[model samples]
Target: MDGTRDPLARDERAELHWLRAENTLLRVQLDILTDIATGYAHDVDTILRLRADR
Candidate 1:
């Protein structure tokens, strides 16, 4: 008996594929957000340092 012929197995495989694709998308989004936050922090630090010099 081939596993592919089973309806339950096919549904599980479809769900697994969708979940993997979603996981990849979320990781990319997280990377973008992290870069934005890092840049914002650096900018704030530079502003504070410049103000302190005055």
Candidate 2:
């Protein structure tokens, strides 16, 4: 039997929307972590340099 004319059913559309939102949230979180790690590395380097010079 032929299925409904719509290529994407309602439930499929909702799931896709939810997945896209989740992906966006994760992307933002990863960006924040990257920035924090970068800052921490810079601070560690500065501390090491100061100790070595003294």
Candidate 3:
């Protein structure tokens, strides 16, 4: 019996694996962006408070 059984089935499985890996990478990047945005927001708030005090 052939290992592939069906060539399309093998290809589909490979594609799905690649997509899952890509999705994981995107999620990690999005989390990093969110963190950066939150940091910037905090910095802006601090600056605003200092300006208001003057």
Candidate 4:
């Protein structure tokens, strides 16, 4: 687009790209955190069940 030379337009595009990258990174981190939380919950439940059996 001819507007690429426009400073304001370029700045807006750069900011949008940065925001998208940050959003993607956050989503990945959230997925990892959720997996870790789920694993911990499962482990805790198992531990409780074992203790109850005793």
Candidate 5:
């Protein structure tokens, strides 16, 4: 076994963990934005429908 290979393996594992954390954070942010957009659309639709009824 090569002694120098252990550090590379450790670095890869660390990088993988960081990438996963970043992905999770980005996904949560995306969900929040989606929720905001959906709410806005609902509000707009409501306003439009109310105006149409008048």
Candidate 6:
């Protein structure tokens, strides 16, 4: 109900946005791993040979 509270609200929104992005990335990673685990040799090989920049 004051200007002081605005900064905290902004920080919370930024954190929530970051968390959502991370969650989406993790879900995709899990899906890829699941595919590889389910006998997808191409996916397995691709993962094995991947040179992740980060």
The lDDT leader among the candidates is 2
lDDT of 3 by residue, 14-45 (tens): 99999999999999999999999999999999
- Estimated TM-score for each candidate: 0.83, 0.84, 0.82, 0.84, 0.77, 0.58
Give the per-residue lDDT of model 5 (tens digit) for 1-53: 66565445888989999999999999999999999999999999999999999
Model 1, 1-54: lDDT tens digits are 565664558889899999999999999999999999999999999999999999
Query: What digit string (tens of lDDT, one per residue) describes model 2 on residues 1-54?
Result: 577586788999999999999999999999999999999999999999999999
CA lDDT scores, all candidates in order: 0.94, 0.96, 0.94, 0.94, 0.94, 0.82
Q: How close is candidate 4 to the true structure, as a TM-score?
A: 0.84
Question: Mind giving the per-residue lDDT tens digits that candidate 6 earns over 1-54?
Answer: 555644458889899999999999999999999887777777776787785533
lDDT of 1: 0.94
At residue 10, candidate 4 shows an lDDT of 83
Clash count, one per candidate: 0, 0, 0, 0, 0, 0
- 1-54 in candidate 4: lDDT tens per residue? 765664568889899999999999999999999999999999999999999999
Pairs that clash in candidate 4? none
Which residue segments of model 4 deviate by more than 4 Å?
1-8
